[model samples]
Target: MLKSWRRRCRRKTGGMPELTIPSHFLCPISLHLMKDPVTLSTGTTYDRHSIETWIEAGNRTCPVTSQVLRDLEPIPNHAIRKNIQEWCVENGSRGIERIPTPRIPITSTEVSEMLVRVSEASDESRCREFVAKIKQSAKESDRNKRCFVANGSTKVLSAAFAAFSNADETVTVLAEILSAMITLTPVLDEETSSNLSSEHPLQKLVWFLRFGSLSARRNAVLALRSILSFDQFKFEIVVKIEGMVEALIRLINEPICPTTTKASLLSIYYLLKPTENSKGIAITLTEMGLVEKLLEMAVDSDRSVCEKALGVLDRMCSHGEVRERARGNALMIPLLVKKVLRVSGMATEFSVSILLKIVRGDEGEEERAAAAVEALQAGAFQKLLLVLQIGSDEVSKEKVTELLKVMNGYRNRIECVDSLDFKHLRRPF
Candidate 1:
């Protein structure tokens, strides 16, 4: 009967050879096909426990290739862990299955070695494959995947940044991250403004803000800044505003960190610009007593920071209430006027352009017109005319025409001691 059972089993297995032992009983860890499998100091094969220890120590590299083992989180050793647990549970009432386990086609050690070699590889095409794998792993929800990205090692960030440095690649990555934020925004909790993680997406955003390249920084700022324009993300928006304000305050206080300071100020400008949903931001700024702080920054010694702060104020000035508040403060106007006069000719032109918006309409027409006329009468027009006169031929004649138009608007109010030739003003000279 046993011979008949064996014959029947062989018949069921078809042309396959008879199994001496069932494959499932074998240890998957030792069975994994590692080209150069890690061997411990004890000369035993490197097992899951050893790998986990190395990973916990933040050594995520293979011994051979020094390639990053992105999948560093612990996994249950199916052979040992399950067997021990079953033995404890059943007290060996059921013997372990005699199945022989098929080896995993690749092991963590092999993958790490391969990745390290790929990282140092000179072949652009292969490097691209490595980058794709890293990004792919980042998108997964597996604990291992999360640990890999959250590792925050310079190698991973550098690799990610370098991969997307090309304009098209950068745009693609930005679009993906933006889309993910939008899709995930709705599902986020309203009260806490946190994402699935305890640290909100904005915290991740701050990471990018601090470490990303110039273009990447710009893109990140633009994305987070856009969220302030939507009411649905109000809580998230507040988080960003807080982050921005903190960064701004730091930048304002720390003169040593100029690049970060300038970047942060520029980011704040983009974040706090006037928009329908950003009315809350204005209120928040006011509540935080940021108006004085912003005004001080507008006159900062650093031209870039000062110019950016001026831009933020200019945008804020679009709101009548904000404008009135700034104007009533008494300090902003003189500072703005000084900026208009103190900058180089082109910068002066930009400052004047911004000032025009403040003084544009009939609502506060007289006050605004008086300010412009004061600036003009203070020889601003003459300085501008001089720029038009002596600067390169590249000067926009239309800008010259615009200046003449501005001067002409007040021509009737001011008496001309000397007859000025409009025809000469019309000429390029």
Candidate 2:
């Protein structure tokens, strides 16, 4: 029976042996023929994409041997990749497609030369064309992005390319530069960010965001998120660029794509993290009606979109003024209650957090008690009880408990709060 099965398999493979990949050509992690192979310090080879994903997830163990990853550096297995390419070519007639040679990532010398050429470009179109090339190359893979950043691309681009704008149609070059700038964010150093921003040359990044093309706006906002990721102080400088805040605020209200909206929200999220004169960043966001914008987004069909919007709202509602603004918006309370369990666990956590903060409002504030009453009258107490009864994460259940306690105290102020409801709501504990 085994001999007959082997004969049949050989016949199916046209007598060219089984269609088996050489063992060394397979990535240890994926157990598939390697494309873009690289070797880790554990002396194990993997496809670049697989290992990069593993490392990006914060995994420090080798997937094959369960050995601790002492270093993340992956040396490209160029020789093995070459052999795989040749093998694929030799077997091309039998259905194996030959993989093209992967483009070599930019080196420090190459990027420096490119930056010099970019600086000397005679026209905005020429500058943007080069920058677009850079952006396209960087986007090819994480390997390429890391290579570009490690090769001094961040410093070169920040100093030279950020200022390349056409007098008549400056948005394109500026946008492309910003787009490329963000790609190097993963490896950006604190000194690099400060050096980039202190030049104040990229404030044009902010200015163009208002009048630039949609592509330009998206790139600009993303770049802002990247630059500000390194230093919170830079956010203050960014918001100081006139119309920048309002423009970012306007991005939320615009009928933009999810990617752009999320970028805008993250920019605002970081900007709101730092305070001045004891003033919270949410004041600016709320004054510009950001709560309503986020509330609208909270009902988005996309789970991640809703999660991010709710996250921003959670932070915003931490401030009293923003909380009052959200209440005034009317959509905030209902949307918050509705998404409690409907979206991701993250969304539920943030939604419940926002409500909990509202319930535990400012000390000696009479309006807070009134707001809690209105929330109960809005059926929040019932929603909390239902959430506890249905069961949720420890975090969510704990939050529900705190919320029930706060609402129970407001029972005298709220006619809708029932004594029997307290027993059910608190039963989760």
Candidate 3:
């Protein structure tokens, strides 16, 4: 159907004579043939879509006239519309066809009123209807979304979400709308951010992670990420939620999809970064068995997931409790060894950093030797050699050398750290 329309509009002559669109028929806003021409209060005529868009963006002046518009209503210029229609039919021999009547745009006032009605909705089914309509409007066009934002849809959505007294059935619908708010507006206002934070929206978001559908859960995660980016205080508040950390850990352990997996990992990773852990956030992560899950994720086939997983692993492993946690998990040593050259260079760096912390003996010499013996048994030497020949930067090289030197002292316990390999390993130092 689309191809036929394009073919009909082309000129048929061999020289391909230019299709001259009438100057008066063009919309000043888009410079295309006007379909539903409308006259503004300033007496300038524009295509309905173009002028409606201009007005919805908070502009009250005409695009062509620049006169301050007196009223919001745009009067339809039916005479110009009929004339354009006649010109299109007259040019139908050149494949041009009459334009179909355009659908009237949903008014900004209508959007604002709908949002107010949604916020004031009393029950689950009613909220669902409003959510569907708002999501449809947002999905219609970026223009509609900007208009919605201009009328303060984000605050209304957050307020409706925060004021929901019954969370059991409304969680899914509320989260769906909140996620739409995220997708529509690139950034949330500080007042909205403050509202969500004070109202503890993170608790509900964490709930959606476990109870909502895939789309609901995905959007919930995205919404959480946006709030967490607000500032350090919001991050601190979210981490303080009773089960928020565990929920992120659970998502990482049982991923619904790679995109959500990355989002969950990012939220957890940010929480573990250099905050005052007197509250034991990292310790809680370790206690909840995050280290083992991270080790598994570090070897993921997706390079980006693997890099982020390794990044979190590196941060967690640097903590005393988390370091001890990784050392105890038998799979951690070999996976770290295997991931060295298996993923991206960033993953390799993080993997090596974990081993260095273990092998360097902050936990004392016994822990260091135990780590060395474990790595040797896991074929750490085999993989380390591959990394050294390929991706290892100077810092990684030095760390590998230090690990091997530590392992060299424990060579008698391990079979793989043999005499011949030592010759190649020592040459680089």
Candidate 4:
């Protein structure tokens, strides 16, 4: 009956192209053209009503696209109503067809080349416009949509990363790629994450963190920082972070990545802050004995990594079990001392502030204070005195004074090093 109707429609339309949908597009319960097109609240059309009904039953899908629709509102259209009725009569009771999955085509090299050229072009405004056009094309063109999912466009993304070696340029490229990836990841298949081309954007992001120019590293970190909010991409993010952490640790040991770059990578770790779901990942890293690896970063020659490592440590220290694990591994004290001494002036200030908080007893007063005193005695007080003496400005002197007050107040069995001859300590001012 549905075939006869389709034939009639064709005949009436003067032999238009046959409406030959793959079995996958056919409704399972009704062996016919999809009816009511499961209009999601957002106006997408899908063939399956139960799926649409299930979505409508909850907050799930668009009526037309079956894209996980959210925030739906009613759309009134007479044509839609007519289409629904015509569809129900012809195929509503028919069984669904058993069709194989559709194969989306890969992006052609032409598209990839165009993307590369746009990414590398000197005109910022033009590049942005090109990116906008590509995104719009992806939304409107079936071919582009399929290509985005199936091919992942590694060559294009690599070209973008390669083009933007400078910080500003890198940031612009990163922003564009991030926006595109965020928009597409949800609609993509889980298998798409593994696609080498699709994974290129993230791979390049990691490379920037590892080996790119300083500005590129900073931009990459900033871009990656935004990806954490994409829930659909969480698994891929976790994988990327693990790989990044390992690479950063290795790089720190090699003395290749500049201090700023190392610092940027360390900052990126904060973006991966462990959530309830990410607790297992944290535990896995801890169990793998990465505490020592992380501690080593705190003393890195790069001031940026040193500061970032302290920030990372402060976060990890907030977790009692992780803190205990770090302390038990003898990885905490030396790092704390380095924070007080080896880091830049601003970093030293920040480190002292963090130490003050750590000693404020979130981990039970007795143990944490004891650790604090041990850290203080292990050269923080002496280093503070040196900073006070050699300090060239008021801010440094003020920071030293503040640190002294904290140390004096905590005078538990730790010996007080003599105050920097206040005379000399004051000379810098």
Ranking by TM-score: 2, 3, 1, 4
Task: Give the higher-TM-score candidate: 3 or 4.
Answer: 3
- TM-score for every candidate vs. truth? 0.41, 0.67, 0.63, 0.40
User: Candidate 3 — which residues are off by over 4 angstroms?
Assistant: 1-112, 115-131, 165-176, 186-190, 232-243, 274-289, 300-303, 325-356, 369-429
lDDT of 3 at 243: 69
Write the residue-wise lDDT of candidate 1 on 1-429 in tens digits. 224445766777656444332233232345432222333333233444345456567776754356666554433334453443443344222222332332333334544654574447454455555545554544443333434333332233334334433333344443333333322222222332222112344544554555555444444444444433344544434444345555444445543355545555555565565556456666565556566777787665566767766666656565656655655565654565576547554445545555555555344767766665655555556655665676533434455556556656875676532346454566664
- The full ranking of all candidates by lDDT, starting with the best, is 3, 2, 4, 1
Model 3 Cα lDDT, one tens digit per residue, 1-429: 223544544634435545778888989989888888998877788887888778878998878777888897887787898898888888776667789865555678898789878888887678878877887887776666777887888888877777772365566567666776776664667766666665346677777776677777777776676666566454656766676777677777777788778888877777776768523877887778777777766655589988888888877777766777788887888888887766678887888888888887578788878998888887777777777777566898898777767777886886874576567555653
User: Model 4: residues >4 Å from true position, as ranges?
Assistant: 1-264, 274-281, 329-331, 379-409, 418-429
Give the local distance difference test score of model 4.
0.54
lDDT of 2 by residue, 1-429 (tens): 224445666788656465677889887778788878988899888988789889989999998989998887777889999999999888765667777777665555666666677667767778778777777877876666777777766676665544543244565665667668776673356655655564254567677678877777876777666667775454556656778878888787884777778778877777766466214557877777778778877776589778888888887777878777776766777777778777877887898899888867774467667667777777778778888888887878999899888878887765785666567464644
lDDT of 2 at 160: 55
Candidate 4 lDDT trough over 10 residues, lowest sum: 95-104
Clashes of each: 9, 0, 1, 15
Better of 1 and 4 by lDDT: 4
Q: For candidate 4, what's the RMSD?
A: 20.6
115: Cα error in model 4, Å? 4.6
